[model samples]
Target: MKRLFAVMLIILLAGSMVFAGGKKESGTIKIAVAGPHSGDLASYGLPTVKAAEIMVEKINAEGGLLGRQVELVIEDDVCKPEVATNTAAKIVGEGVVAVIGHICSGATKAAMGIYNDSKILAISPSATNPALTQSGDYPNFFRTIASDDAQARIEVDFALDTLGLTKIAVLHDKGDYGKGLAEFAQKFLEADSRAEVVLFEGVTPGAVDYTAVINKIKNSGADGIIFGGYHPEASKIVSQMKKRAMDIPFISDDGVKDNTFIKVAGDYAEGVYASGPMDTTTNPLTIQATKEHQEKYGEDPGAFYLNAYAALQAVFNAIEVAGSTDYDAVTNALRTSYVETTLGKIKFDSKGDAEGVGFSMYQVQNGVYVELK
Candidate 1:
């Protein structure tokens, strides 16, 4: 009788172990969508949150990944590097396995070191600074959007080949994202030898007026100007140009992709050209996602939305591939996995940048941004 009791006890203990392991499995996953949710760049942040929310809802409807209900905790970093560092600390402390952003490049770079040391994954939708991924300092960091290096190439090609505009003036906000893009433009622009970088300057981001900068552009005899900054300042520069009756081709990078640029620049926006992330409208998944966004949010998704949603999906794919929430496992799985998201089939290289990069050019036509082929 004593022998029989021992066998039963062993069986009970084995079953309990399996049960406990099952309970601790990938269930109730939580992700922090960190960005400038409430600041001057709020326009960019709102769509990122909305896209994540929409994707989360769809994942839940499909019974969630790993039979778990996913929850998104919105963490606002306000696009400031100092605030981003603090927010990153908070996110790590809160036990999140992944983060979707800190949209601006400076913010992402500030927060990435913490995530790297902790082995937490971060996939940025819009942070395009090449160093963020190129330097290999943050193994856990990845971005859905193309780096500014690719963007600079696109802008230069258009300036030299398409428009044949050679005399160029470049201005930056002196922030990580802006200054990096501006210097990159100048480098490639001068390297080609076909184009002349007439002026390279930095402007204060929140200054009320850009009259002084406008005078510089005018005096530089630059037929075209490339502003490497967010839309708010880019709009001001263009508007000031319009005030001076300067109808030159003012080209900018993805920072000016939002409709806010058009609204702020008013009629002057007519000729302004901005290069944005890939136009994913051709993809069936993107079309469905955009429809769902409108149905759920009562509005259309922004230029950055598809990439944000894909970032979240990439994280989820990693979790599923790892078959658990182990950070190291997911990180390894992400590097090897090819994810077909709204952006189409995308895979990350060793430095965590997308395998290929693409961008779409936009021109303000009739006070609205129209995609230019």
Candidate 2:
């Protein structure tokens, strides 16, 4: 009887030790990385995931935050708003300290309500629709990239003052970012600038042919065309225009600025101009990081990935300043913190938006994106 009691006590103590060890391991500082990991837009999402992975690795290697290794919990929102909301809820349920994604503006907007309700701090690296920051309810939401309004203002200046374009046609994909940017540009061009939007229309995203739209623009007698959409749709439109012998200069927002656009559009991408915050290729740090990324991953990093890296840095900086994993504390710290990231110094305004940054214009030459003056 004595031996049996001793053995039972030993078993109970061993079980208690196992449970305690599990609890300690589970005390990880989890940062959720949500994006369209599996979709036609996977190129955009995958790079963000890779960037977050790199950031986590770097953070962990340096003894991590608050003496605990950072852990990344990535979720695929598939670039859909509903999926994004669900993913945000799941991340919150998993007790992640913060979130760094839902790359598309629509997805970010969808998840905003949940994040706000849950008091989870979410910083988007790529979502650029003006509404996300301007919306009054999203106090916990933040974005690293400049808004479409800024991009539009810069592109409009280039179109009128630099390119000397008088008449232009604006086309958009009808997505949140696309339509927001197109409408914003149109308003600015018509009201503030000498440029006239001769033709404005929405195109169905993922359509293989845009011959009808191209013909409309051709007949509209516009000297230039601005497309507000991603590379896939923009490439198809440009390629189709080439088939129709449309020689009008093509301009686009950052959505269409990617190497994949050049590859898909082939020679047609040459002379295509795009406006965004300076391309990652132009930044020395980004250039070196791209080389390292290529060496490690066998491919160059995408534009959004660099933005994600900056966003992650901002979040971690806020975490360190707050000195605790509490979401509200970190959120407050983010608003008050001055973080120097890959994009330079970042300071947020009351609206949770970056301040006083300008956009850079780039043009494709010989299948490579080069910054244009």
Candidate 3:
């Protein structure tokens, strides 16, 4: 009887150990989706959340990664740097294997150190600041979008060569993203002898009125303007410019390329030139993604929707290919493997920028952004 009791105790201990191990190993894999899911920039972040949901559904239906159901740890930073740090900490605490957001550059930059220290891989769909990848500080960071320098080149070239604008005013919202792109534009314009930067200035964002800055641009005799900021300020500046009867070609960066800019600025949005990612709507993957989004969400996907979808797709693919969620393993797979995304067949370069992704010029015509041919 003593021997039998001892044997039973040993078996019970082994069973408990096995059950605990199984519970740990069989739990769902968590991927975080962080961005501005509320506030004025909600248009930029909610699409990513929806994309993750759709991707999670599709991935689970297709057996998920590593035979584990994929889960999303969605958090909103509202595109604020202070909020992004807290969001990053929350995501880390949540035990996510990877991250897919912090859509704005300032927010992404703020969160990157935390993710780097935690050894979690992050892929941004629209954090276009060049330093995020080029600075050599965050090896675990990758992105599905072109950087601001590249977009700046596109905007500068379009202004100089295409639009034949010589004297240009370069204005920014003084935030990290806006200032970074504006600086790049200023550099490019200064380098080219064909054009001159008539004015380089920063405006406080969320200001109720910008007529004072508009008057500055008018007084500078700028033939065109390169406004580096998002849609809200862009809409306000452009509306004020139009109200003052100043046309002079309001050229800006991808920050102003979103549809919300048009919706907010209304008729003033017309003729505004902005540079954004090259249109990949012709790709079959893009078509399918759009269809899925429309069917499920009852509306067109918002800004950076496909890019966010592609970011999540790349993360999942890397995990599957590495066959483990180890930080180095997944990041290695991401660098070495090619994943077919809405952007088409692509992979990350050493600098974490996506291969084959680039910017294109667009003009707001007939209340829609028409890609310039």
Candidate 4:
């Protein structure tokens, strides 16, 4: 009896010690790839996942980063601000050295506070709200995309100077990204003496119908419309406009500049103009990246695919340059070191925007988006 009791006590002590030590670290370096992995915005986030997977596979094949195999921790936020805070907390809890997403502007804005507090470096491929970096609130935040201010200038200039439009309706989806962009569009149009903004409105996302707003746009006698929302809302509005014979030119921002929008809007998408990351088709790196994606996925890469690929390249390169994942060192290296990516050789500017990254106007023609010359 005494021998048995002593054996039981020893086993219990060993179990308690293991429990007290918490999760044991694996040999691989863990990086979180977070975004709206499911939901309507899944199309936007899944490409980043594939980009990271391909990049990591290439990295490991090249002997890995810092001689350690890299692992990914993917999380889904569904592009909601409320869900994003929780996702951010979960990523911090997972002991990741860095993060690659929180794709939407509102979600990215929500997650940055947590990342800043935890000292984790986060580089977003598509979060473009100016305040995310310009406000000086998130020192740990960086992105590979240009901000909306630049995009808005391109859009307004295209409308007034290129297309010769004088009166326009500016509309948004009532979300952080959509409304913020619409506000900038309104500001620029109001500043331009050649144009007049006939209407500025925000519509509820996922509504069954947008007839009310369509009526407003028609009644305003606007010769053109500028949309500040994603493809889902944009497609619905454009489809409705076409159905009503309101054939004025529809201009939109990067949010609407997606193949999914073209698919959803069908023939109505014809001649719709939107601004997106400038065409990099001529870049050799881009050609190689596209080829790799085609071979791996058996399909054309989706929206923001190259931008996401560039983000991973930038992050891993920064880690290599800094020699460690120290937050200050990695971020400093990001701002100082240039990495050749699908976007060409680029580095982060002081405000976290990617240098040499800018927007270009595109039009949906014959079932595909064609870059305007």
lDDT of each: 0.86, 0.83, 0.91, 0.90
TM-score-best of 3 and 4? 3
Q: Model 1, range 35-132, lDDT digits (tens) per residue?
A: 99886899888899999898899899999988899888789999999999999999987667789997999999999999888778999999988889
Q: Tell me, what's the RMSD of every candidate?
A: 7.7, 9.2, 7.8, 9.1
Residue 369's lDDT in candidate 3: 97
**lDDT tens digits, residue span 1-373, model 2:** 9999999999999998898566445567889999888879888888888888888887899998888889889999999998888898899877777888878989999998898887788888888877788776788888888876987777777888888999999999999888988888898889966778999999998776788888899899999987887898898888888888888888898888888889889999998999866644456666665665787689878758777887888899988998887777788888888887777677677777875345788999888888886
Task: Tell me each candidate's TM-score.
Answer: 0.63, 0.63, 0.64, 0.64
Which stretches of candidate 3 lie above 4 Å from their native place?
Answer: 1-25, 154-276, 360-373
Q: Give the TM-score of candidate 4.
A: 0.64
Could you arrange the candidates by lDDT from highest to lowest? 3, 4, 1, 2
Off by over 4 Å in 4: 1-26, 154-276, 360-373
Model 4 per-residue lDDT tens digits across residues 1-373: 9999999999999886676343323357778998999999999999999999999999999988888789899999999999999999999988788899879999999998998898998999999788898898988888988877877878888999888999999999999888888899999998889989999999999999999999999999999998888999999999999999999989898888989998889999999999997878899999999999999999989978999999998999998999876678889999999999999889998888888788889999999988887
Question: Best TM-score goes to which candidate?
Answer: 3
- Listed per model in order, the count of residue pairs whose N, CA or C atoms clash below 3 Å is 0, 0, 0, 0
User: Against the hidden true structure, what lDDT does model 4 obtain?
Assistant: 0.90
User: Alpha carbon lDDT of residue 105, candidate 2?
Assistant: 89
Model 1, position 280: C-alpha lDDT score: 66
